[model samples]
Target: MHSSPRSRRIDEHTIRSLPKAEVHVHLEGTFSLLDILTLAKDNGVRLPGPAATLFDITTHDAFTAPAVTSGGGAGAGAAGLSGFLRFLDWQCGLVRTPAQAARVAYAFAARQSASGVRYSDVIVNPTHWNAWHGRELALMDALASGFDEAEQDGLCAVSIAYSLLRSQSAADAEAVVTDLITRRPHRVVALSVDGDEKVTGRTGEKFRAAFARAAQGGLHRTVHAGESSGPEGVWDAVELLQAERIDHGVRAVEDPALLDRLVGGGISLGVCPRSNVTLGISPSWHEHPLRRLHEAGVLVTLNTDDPAPLGTTLEADWAVAAEQFGFDHADLVGFAARSIDASFADPDTKASLHTELASVAASAVDATTTA
Candidate 1:
């Protein structure tokens, strides 16, 4: 039965009220356009266009807009994943100082709190931050300091995942792991690798030693695969990199054997449906493989991959699962529970969040019965 407007509103309310955890989100992509405008002015970086008209040009339109190229004019650089990535590099370049980094981190935490995300594993790619090149450790410290303040102020608790670029050399990857092990920057919980897999194909063998070192040093592993490439990349992530979680593993649905492997190995997939649609990975929401993957019993959780540029929020993503994918209240609650389990949070935090989720789930059940 089609849900009434009132029922949809209730569902949205319930999703927003749920204490949630997000496992895949990029800190660099969290900045609002206004945030970018402010940062640009602060740093004296000229935008590709005027601020007032920039919004119309930079916003993404899946059908009409061409893929954004590096150094392209305003609208051209905000359309596809590659273009969105260039925008990330440009906006991140504006944060020249540690204080600016802190400001953005605190703002991210605050936004998460507003959206009912109690905890998030935020990915930080040093390659995006042009100003912080060769000073990644200092950048990490600045981000951690900001998150620490946010946590102390009772905002969402955040953990960092230091990501390696796909194009980086094996030595560069090893150095990142070594730095993480030696310094042990606060709130950094995992090691991840993300870049355009289409541009640099099959790099798992290249970063294997570095990921192994990360494992030996007690860091959790997550890899981006199956988005730009096919199931082969997902296989490398599991077999070669030993990733506990796969980001954008939607393409695994194409290979039943890979689906079996993911399910058997208990690997979690951080599937961002709208992002897939926006980037032309999947043709539309209904065609997206999130439903197929979830039905196959793979541990799947919804996320907003790059919220700001993509124009998404965690709550809105959950709503898509409900309204588009036909996940009911119980299923949504289950996904939320699985997200906490898949997180790199402490056991105590996971347990506590589960308890809180249980309370909200019960209330949701009651409200549904009444409605």
Candidate 2:
């Protein structure tokens, strides 16, 4: 629960102006408070009491509250990531149509643009969206359409990573990957695994066949590991699932051999600082192993795991990295560069974003100099 005061060396404006890419954001977790309210009312879903009282989606600590009540009883705070996952299920459930899903995607794009995110690899667990019940492909198309619409408007460019929920069956996981490869939905970049890792207990061996299929089909691989489970989960992800990038691999700091493997293999760890604190994985930002991982030669990248639900933006994460980890502006820029390198984006797109990020950083520096 402890944290250092915000650094005076960085300001919100500067942080927002830093061009960045968000590789770990969840599409279902992108719902804003206003969007939540609108979706619930439109679908005749009742929420607990006043919107503000349900939960404060403004701070990381608040996300640790108990189960959120939907209608009658008092809304509980999010107990942990497990509780948050249930809340995510309910929030995404409110969108019962393709158009609504599109709206959610577009809204997420708009929010990311406002925070200076130039690119995003948004993850979605299709099972969580009840609206997509028997129409997963349709849901994917709608989401792609929304992202395309946003890209057309010159907002953030978007991609999708069809995530397999850990709670689901191995057969279900293979089916999702099979469908993703078969459909080849627009802007689909990779296959991913998400959900509370503790419940799943490092079942990487179970998904190897599916991941192998994805690799054969040219889709990239990334897996959620080492967040809730131990370093062994990360090891399984690398050895069995062949994850090119791991979401929240902070626990790798505990195992020297695992850390060496990550370093040698050039696997990127998409570290979400606020998420770790909110989920009780790390006691505070200062205690986070991000800097340690970076210093140890791990390809570390900063990201907002779930912006709206966690009440954190990429800009906020960068600021915290600066304030707590003593990263300078250049260091923040490097984090963005590494994200681009680690992304499943096409080479041409990656080159374009690299150029754009450099220009933006130069401009920001020039403006600071003049001031």
Candidate 3:
């Protein structure tokens, strides 16, 4: 019993028009090596390797260098966040000024705009580029300036969560939170706990304190939990530090109780499927638990994590999720709404965005049916 091609057309239209919320994007992860070279040339920084280094987005042989980190031991889990972080090490080297920061920020925003992302919480690693210039304020200002420019261009709205490198002192992480509270970039909305979580098993209480201070200051909290490790890390993020969202909670399936806890708590899991597949989390996209979680009532939001390096876009992620996760119009729209519920924005803004998403999603359905 073949229904019709019209059903397929409607499905594709609905995916494109589904209102979207991108809750986890690393500003450094957004740094494409090609984009890095442009910034380097503008700032006159020397990339130690070949000009070809401009496009190396994967586990690089040049792990310890300036641009990005990669090729870690199997213990560190390269090709996932490690490879992504390595790219940050590279991008931050070239961003030495307020102008440079703004350029990078704007470039990332433009890419987001092209992806049809309506709201984004972009993670910014302060020390990455700031170290090159020896100025923290420049990184902050560049982010602020970038948002200003993007809004004027009618691009999608964007926000920043100043990410503390895992290696940074509690004092340094606190300093960044202090800046967020004091300077208060409207676009810089939250304080994200990023960097390698593996540091905690080896080290001390700085991670705990940094998140506590951020919470005490009324900063919205998100953490990169259970990305590489097991569901225990997810539990640690939920029980120990009180994270609002888990960046990659793929292993939640391993613990049914934890899985139920996430669903019951209404915590959004920023699931990156292709990234999981590329990094070997699951053997293939079809194996991703995003579908399982969504059906199980966990708030699931789709994101690219980083686009250029992964050569992925948010729209592409949605498509894959739709195809792989068996998402229908209602499912994706519900997923979009989940992002709104978990957002750090004020009620009015969140309300407005919600309205916009619904209207757009409705119109998309109408158009699809008509065509």
lDDT of 1: 0.83
lDDT of 1 at 218: 98
RMSD of each: 4.0, 4.6, 4.2
Model 3 earns a TM-score of 0.86
Give the runs in model 1 whose Cα sits over 4 Å from its true position. Answer: 1-10, 53-79
lDDT of each: 0.83, 0.79, 0.68
The TM-score values for the models, in the order shown, are: 0.91, 0.90, 0.86
Q: Please give the lDDT score at residue 305 for candidate 3.
A: 72
Tens digits of per-residue lDDT for model 2 on 1-371? 01333344566577777777888877877788999899988989888446884545323343345543211100122254444655666777898877888898899899999988888888877877766777887888988888899989999989988887666678987888888888899888898887666554667878889899999999998888898788999998999998999988999999999999998999999888887887778889889998889889999988887777666677877887788877777777888899888888789989998998899899878988999
Displacement of the residue 251 alpha carbon in candidate 2, Å: 0.4
For candidate 3, lDDT tens digit of each residue in 1-371? 11221122224344556656678777777766667778778877777567664445443565534343321111123543444456466667777667777877788878777766667788776656645445665577777798789879987678777666556677877777777777776676677665555544521256677677777877877777666677887887777667888887788877889988998887888887776776677778767777777667788777777666667677777766666555666667777787777767678868987998889878867987999
Q: Model 3: runs farther than 4 Å from truth?
A: 1-14, 46-53, 57-61, 64-84, 130-134, 198-205, 368-371
Stretches off by above 4 angstroms in model 2 are: 1-8, 56-78, 365-371
Instruction: Give the least accurate 10-residue stretch of model 2, judged by summed lDDT.
Output: 69-78
Task: Estimate the TM-score for candidate 1.
Answer: 0.91
